[model samples]
Target: MEFMEVIRKRRSIRKFKPEPVPDELIMELLEAARLAPSGTNLQPWRFIIIKSEEKRRELLGHTVNFVVTAPVVIACCVDLNTYKQHKPQRIKELTRAGAFSGVDLNFNDGDKYWKQRGALNANEIREYVSINCAVAVQQLVLRATDLGLGTCWVMMFDQDSVKKILGLGADIDVLALIPVGYADQDPAPRPRLPVRELLIKELK
Candidate 1:
């Protein structure tokens, strides 16, 4: 499918059919996410694919019961260490890969970075992980849509409860719970703000 069409066709589907999504297709979806770009190419995201009926029931407990009806649920996560704990290593690797163009040290990891890190109290780590993981999540979502699958990126849930349910450690955090499967219903697209209103004029 065309890229723009895929983006336009993608929707947040809440209801899904009982049919099961093939394991291969699921793997392909993850592959798309794996190819997403990340800060210093650290690739700090991990995923949990929930497909078993019993586990799905457990997941339903974390969010609204209705969403778990999908054949699969992916727990998108980010490793906190991807930034704070491994900044130097990632920067070194990025330089080797010719990705860390010094345009960013003086562009990669410089005195200003360490100073900002000290000032931010490590919050910069969250910022990096969040952006990287979000990019990956969107990649997965778009790939799933391209495969004729429906997905709902769920965020409004008890994060702590979900962590406990999945036995996740503090080192990782869930960004979204994407329920993927065949759409049970296809409603009209929701309203969107006008492009002119959303796009602002460039500053001279």
Candidate 2:
């Protein structure tokens, strides 16, 4: 599908058919995410894909009915271990690459902006960590749309339970739950702000 058409047609699909998403197509979607940009190239997204019937059923209430019904559910996660492991290298890279051609990069910009919360707590760091995963999630959904699959980005799940269910270690955090499958209903386009209203200013 054309890029714009794919973007326009993508919806937060809730109801899904019973067919499973093909592995080949799933890899293609993940490939889109693998190419997403990240701060200091610190790609921290970790995907935990759930396809087993028992697992999905177990996640039903913790997540939503969609998890039980959709053929696939992906747990989008952020790896604190990866961040810690690569921190030194990423700081060097970010500082060396800099913000732009002229602007110097303060690699510790994260420190400055976030440290005000007293000792740079996990909550503050979570904001930056989630960006990498969020970008990947966007890519996954767009690719899913192009493949004629439907997806819903879910965040209302019990986070701790999801972590336990996935057997994730302390180094990982659940960022989102995406249920993917064939759409059962054709939802109408949602309302949106007009182009002019959305734009702050348009360059000539």
Candidate 3:
């Protein structure tokens, strides 16, 4: 499928068929996520593919809105250790290098930034790492759409429950849960803000 077509046609699929998704296609979707760009190319994302019915049911119980009818649920995780724990020195270097050029790094009189930097606990860093994982998640969703598969991005779940469900180490953080499979219903396009309302153009 064409890129634009995939983007336009992609919808948040809530209903799915019971048909099984092949391992090769799942790998392809993972590959798309693997290739997504990351801050400093850190690539901190990890995916846990859940296919067992019991585990899927348990996951659904945690996030009732999650589309577990799909054959697969991919739990996206972010590894905080992957990027040296977001130190102030590194942030200074990144700022000096213009790594965040055209972006604002300030956060509430700098307290928010320092608070994030000082995050030594898993919960604190989990929020930080989840931001990076979101980029990879977008890639996965788009690639799944291109592959003629449907997907739903689920976030309303008990984090601890998910951690226990996947038996993930305390160091790893779950960012998002995505269920992928063949669609059972064709959903209409969701409305979006008009470009005129959403975009602000500055003509020089």
Q: Identify the leading candidate in terms of lDDT.
A: 1
Which candidate, 1 or 2, would have the higher lDDT against the true structure? 1
Give the runs in model 3 whose Cα sits over 4 Å from its true position: 85-127, 201-203
- Each prediction's Cα lDDT score? 0.84, 0.82, 0.81
Work out how many backbone clashes candidate 1 has.
2
lDDT tens readout by residue for model 3, 1-204: 988999998999988889999999999999999998765466789999999878788876788554567789999888878756545556576667766555355442233465665645665556656777898999999999999999988888888988998898867878888999998889899889998997688688
lDDT over C-alpha atoms for residue 6 of model 3: 90
Q: Report per-prediction Cα RMSD to one decimal.
A: 2.4, 3.3, 5.1
Predicted structure 3, TM vs. truth: 0.80
Stretch of 10 with least lDDT, candidate 2: 99-108
Off by over 4 Å in 2: 94-119, 200-204
- TM for every model, in the order presented, reads 0.89, 0.85, 0.80
For model 1, name the residue pairs that clash.
Answer: 104-107, 105-108
Q: What is the lDDT of candidate 1?
A: 0.84
lDDT of 3 at 2: 88
Q: lDDT tens digits, residues 11-95, model 1?
A: 9999999999999999999999999998667788999999888888887667977668998999899898777667777666666
Q: Taking the tens digit of each residue's C-alpha lDDT, what string does model 2 give over 83-199?
A: 667766775666576532342343346443323434435765677779778998899899999999999889989988989989998889999999989999899999999998989
Pairing residues by index, what is the TM-score of model 2? Answer: 0.85
